[model samples]
Target: MIKLPTVSLAAIGYEKFLWKNITELLKTGMLIIGIYYCRKIYKKLDDLQKKIDKGEQDKYDFQKKFEYSLDKIKATIDKGEQDKYKIKQEKDNIAQEKDNIALEKELNKEIEQLKKEIERKKAQFKSAWREIPLYADWRKEEFQTVKLTLDAATAHPALFLSEEGRIVTWQEPCQELPSSPERFVSIPCVLGQLYVSSGRYFWEVEVQDAHSWDLGVCRNNVARTGRVTMSPQNGFRVIRLYDGEYWGLTSPETSLTLKEKPCRVGVFLDYEAGDVSFYNMTDESHIYTFSKQAFYGGLRPLFRLWSSDSGPLVIVQVEENTTML
Candidate 1:
């Protein structure tokens, strides 16, 4: 066998040292690369943490703003409820005031009506007292004479006429008079033959024993065939006597309280001046007057006797000199 060469110890040592240095250098390069990659990963992690913190802060600010807006809305809703309550209270007060004013007006109207009725009664009483015996004789000098006669054609069937148709008496049994359209059928009444249109006339009627009677002047076209109330609307202006009470025949009948009963009644008429006056002939005092009358046509004397009254209603004959007294 042939031996090649024998290695030296120094050469072997140098080769081992070279191998160790190469190993150390490779380890250092690997450590440097690891450090650079670790630093890059740390920077990325830090940036992600900052973004998370900012998101949390933004969420907190949004919650605070939402709470503030909700509080403002609650306050506005409370104020709106308060305003609605005030509006309802004001409307109720206005309605109550109108009702009170209407009630006051109705009360005033009733009071005024009562005053007028009182005044009318006062005037009636004053005229009635003037017909007393003390003042009766004093009014006799103002009398004027007028001749009057009853119209037989206008007399009721229950009435009997005498003294040239100047006297009328209510008979229980009806007379055998002809039924005429112008005659009074139910009431015991009569009309005068003479009618005065536009002149002053005066006449006297004697009702000494009569209980109830009506004496007046009526228009020529007054109702004569039926039962009629002696009123101004019916063309009859009169003084009525029934049940010991007297009344003036107006649209609404007015009561006339007399102090004394007159045996004879005097009637005076001024047609042009529209005046009809009555007087108590026995006492010669003024009784009542019909004023402000509208005389459209001829006016005739009208007389009515109650059904129960049996006494005669006579037209008294007045001498020209006695009427002037």
Candidate 2:
């Protein structure tokens, strides 16, 4: 502790010298000096220690509060993320529900339409049966012929006789290039009919060697005849015929590598009004035909394969009106 100034009452006792020295100002100075020294010493030691403790406690408290606030803020952010996820999930669920409903409605509509179609077909069948009383006995006649295989180069080629007895000659590739620079000689029929009926026609050829190619009748060269040519590129195609005045029918719509092996393909023609149908000779199921409208003029209703790629062509007339009746 700090030593304070002590002023005694004897100093102010009433002795002549004491009374002379005992002034009011001296007494007040001594008291004020004792109080200031004691307060200064307290502040330097114990009071300063209390102030430090208070400051540390306040800092600790503030830190704890800050940590709690951070936790709350983090919790709020997490809640927002969770809410977003829930909203997306809800939207997805709603979309799925709508899709399911639409699908069900479409299926129901299709089922009803099918039922109506079935009933209509059944009624039409009954009506047709009633109209044709001799339907069961309606038998078609069949015709047989001696298929001819002719050599057009050596012998004057015999013209193919149609069911109508009209001499119909098909243009075919018959002669092979005799010279070293080999080229094929194509024989094509000049067609007269420009219009066709809605009917199916079949033709066949027996190829012993590689040289058989059929030439189709086209209206004009303007109707580009697509052909999958011997060219490895541009596959099977419809080639423009006679300076673009006709069309050349290619067997396969796409061309494949030609093999040395002998193979035969059958050609089928399905004519419908202005439409001329064609299919691959290898498989009749592959229907590929050009529209008559696309032709410059009209389709020449006649065709023949009379050329040779390497050898002679042996064409067999398989279909006749007598046999097809």
Candidate 3:
């Protein structure tokens, strides 16, 4: 408590006291205001920090979802491509199977055709080679060369006569032929215009094309209707090539083997000798002989075609001066 220059120490004591109290009050109020402001600012800062954290979390979630969606889309694309490849592969397999089936069917057809051809060749080889005496020209001269032609009057409905009635072909669907007693039925056949009851006659027939025919002599009074027996005992002295096999019309059909296939066949018929000899004129070789057989009535040159597949038989005419036939 020191005395001031203008006032006494005791007089200034109360003023100092008052000034000190007021100063203390201002300091306390300022400290409280500072604390309040600091607290509010800290609270606002904390709230702002929370919001930023939430936003970051949302961004992270969004990024993760985007990545997941990308991966899912990629997987879906891969699966789609795999399915497309599988479908294409299946289609290719089906096309290949169809091709295989078609190839197999074609191969089977070829195999069947080859087998048939092999069988046909085998039959030809079996009947190919035989050693026999060649007919002498003098013996051939003993027979008269008969110029014969097929008779249309005695032709079957299925037979077609052409080439000056020298060709007799087996026609399909038959022709509109007039019915007669001389016309053959149930069999495709034709008789010659001239009939021989006597004398030894020799004639050559051009039997071209596939062999399914009969050539020889038949009795004029043979059966015209129904199944006519072609045996020699049944009025038919014939030799036929049937189903690639040759047969002489005997009581029990004799099989004939030849060294060569003859396109032109020569038939020598002796009525009194009862000998009907067939010759392969193409090779000048004897085929088969119908020996020592009884003959009666007029015998005509018979041409029989077994089926529609049988080729035409052409009566050959030669200019050789032998006996008049």
Candidate 4:
């Protein structure tokens, strides 16, 4: 047989040692690579934690700003309520002032009306006191003798005249007197015999128990044939009594309110002065006056009676005054 070379134990041990070193190097390299990978994982987890912390901080800041805005809104609402209350109070004050002004105006108007009424009453009392004494002096100066006699020729047909012609009474339709142009036709009236053209004269007439009568003077040419109104426009100036009322026979008849009715009436005439005055002889009080008239023609005393039952109107003769002006 052919024989080969033999192997040693030391070479086998060296190969074993070399293999052990190479295995140790590989375990060390694997441990280093595992440690590097663990560090990369830790870095990635730390970045994620930082992002979560930043998000929490941003949430906290947003909550703080929202709370501040809510506080501002709450403060504005409180101020608005206070301003509304103040406006309401001011409106109430203005309304009350308007009512007070209206009440003051009504009180002032009533006070003015009362002042006017007090002044009117004072004037009436002063006028009555001044008239009493002035009438007494006028009666003494005007007293005189005047003889009035009725003319039968001019008397109404219904009149009954005394023989002396001093009295006239109204009677029913009597025998017609001779129709003359100067006689009254349908009225109970008569004219005086004496005509007065000038100078002052005084006369008195008794009208006792007469229901109605007219006493005055008329123009001698006055209408004696028809019924005539006893007015100055009809040439008569007179005082009349009818239905218990006295009137001054003027163009527009004037009513007179007398304190007393006179049984006897006195008449005074100033022909040149054109004044006619009447007096109540029972009380010596002046009754009325016809002032400043124009006596154009001759005037005669006139009389009118209501009826026969009304009683006669008598022409009274006064005694002549010895003490004369």
Candidate 5:
């Protein structure tokens, strides 16, 4: 280095002092800049903390809403299941009722069929009893056989009775007979003298020669003075043969069909049983029966000749132990 001039102590001290001052100034400037930058960083951190807190609150609300939605979905599912179970239960009940109705109908049908079968069997038994052999002899032995005859006191004006009171015939001109309370006025009829109150008896009448006749049981106190309708209600349970047709003189007359024309008719009475039955002696076949009659006191055997030209009807006297066949 070139030594030009001599330096003073004061100048050196001054230069040193100046250098120290400048160094201190530079340090202070750097400290101030650091402090400013630190303040800015603190502000940014505070803003970031606020944003984090807001996001946390938002997350909490969203979680609560999601949980509530899940619970609602679960309740809806449970209700749907409950409704489905109830529907199934009702359906099962309806099906059971239908099955019960069907079973009842089947049982009712079976009961009706059984009743019809029983009735048919009863009718068959009755027919068999009539068709058996030796039945006439058995009836004569078992029951009373009466030789019934017409009462002259009960004969009509136009009817003529035999001496033994066993035959009745209608004549053209009515006789001037003495008036009696028991005599038939309008009807050409006659009755038996026996007052049958109870018990069983049978009689036979020959009807082959008679063109038209009426035969049946009647009440002992029946109408004999005036015009009368022959019916069960009118105290007459009779069968009529008019022209060529046979009919039961019921309230509504019942037409009868016969397999063979009846020559001799047998009347069987069961007083206690309220039955009056007729049979054909030729074929031994049952003709008809008047059943369940409400007889109060007594009954009588009635006979009627319809016209003057009607042939004679004879009462067959059945001896004891005699066979009708």
Candidate 6:
């Protein structure tokens, strides 16, 4: 309320003065009451706010402690999981080592057995009746040490001759002899030494026809190069007969005659449990072998025939002491 000037001050009567004093007293009383109540309410509110703030701080503290504990528990669990994994890996490594040891032992046994066979063959060298070249010059009987050559047999038919009267030659007049496994087998080498090592080999050939020419492991004759037949009816053939190189591996008890070309042909040895494996000599990556067959090498007068004509067969006397690189 606007403080109206006390109109009683201008009044000349005693009642006016009394009215002015009463108004002033009423205004003073209101001011005192308002101040007292306001102070009391503000204090009460301040106290209530302080209590709420304390409760919130306690909640925040509890939350922080709970979060810290959860983090610690997670870390412990992770560490335990890592420990378990480490233990498992160690166990696996131990098992693998044991397995490797066992495999090595088996390989050693096989090596020893092979050595014994080699020794026996060496002992029988002199007594063995092997076929030497019929030529007058003994040096002519030696088998040529083979090396890779750029010359490839012309893309003509492979001529073959049987021990029987039939003369087989590949050409326009001669119909390609039916590729029979029996016809293309390896003939035994009556003389000379055959050596081979076990390993992977890569075999690569550029041929017009894969079926016409049989390439794989073979035994006996140089003609067939001891190639394995490519069919279950026969077997997989890995022997290669072309320019001049001849290579193959023979297992024990299997007898074979490594004759020169023209006489190159397949011969069946009396190997009851002989095995001859053929591998790619260049890269040493592919392997072909007979599952169950007899293996033999001796001085028997067997010759390998390459072409059907006997003219191409060169009888060379191979020195036993010479080493092949």
Q: When superposed on Cα atoms, how far off is each prediction in RMSD?
A: 11.0, 15.6, 18.0, 16.2, 9.3, 19.6
Question: Top model by TM-score, which number?
Answer: 5
Candidate 6 error regions (>4 Å) = 1-45, 124-325
List the candidates ranked by TM-score, beginning with the highest.
5, 3, 4, 1, 2, 6
Candidate 5 to truth, TM: 0.61
Clashing pairs counted in every model: 3, 42, 0, 0, 0, 75
TM-score pick, better of 1 and 6: 1
**Which is superior by TM-score, 3 or 4?**
3
Q: Candidate 2 — which residues are off by over 4 angstroms?
A: 1-39, 42-45, 134-325
lDDT of 5 by residue, 130-235 (tens): 6664455456555578878789998999999999999999876898999999899988899987678877778888998687999988998889977799999889
Evaluate residue 111 in candidate 1 and report its C-alpha lDDT on the 0 to 100 scale.
75
lDDT per residue (tens digit) for residues 129-212 in model 1: 664554534444554566688999998888888958889887777879887888887667789987888766778899997878
Give candidate 3 regions above 4 Å deviation: 1-136
For all predicted structures, in order, the TM-scores are 0.56, 0.29, 0.57, 0.57, 0.61, 0.28
Q: After superposition, how far is residue 267 of candidate 6 from its true place, in Å?
A: 39
Clashing pairs for model 1 are 136-283, 136-284, 141-325
Poorly placed runs, candidate 5 (over 4 Å): 1-120, 131-138, 321-325
lDDT of model number 6: 0.39
**Residues forming the 10-long window of minimal summed lDDT in candidate 3:** 127-136
> What digit string (tens of lDDT, one per residue) describes model 4 on residues 252-294?
8888877778898888777787878787777766677775778
Candidate 3 C-alpha lDDT tens digits along 63-173? 999999999999999999999999999999999999999999999999999999998896565334312335524456777776788888899998899969888887888
**Model 4: C-alpha RMSD to truth?**
16.2
Residue-level lDDT for 75 in candidate 6: 91
Would you list the C-alpha lDDT of every candidate in the order shown? Answer: 0.77, 0.42, 0.83, 0.77, 0.81, 0.39
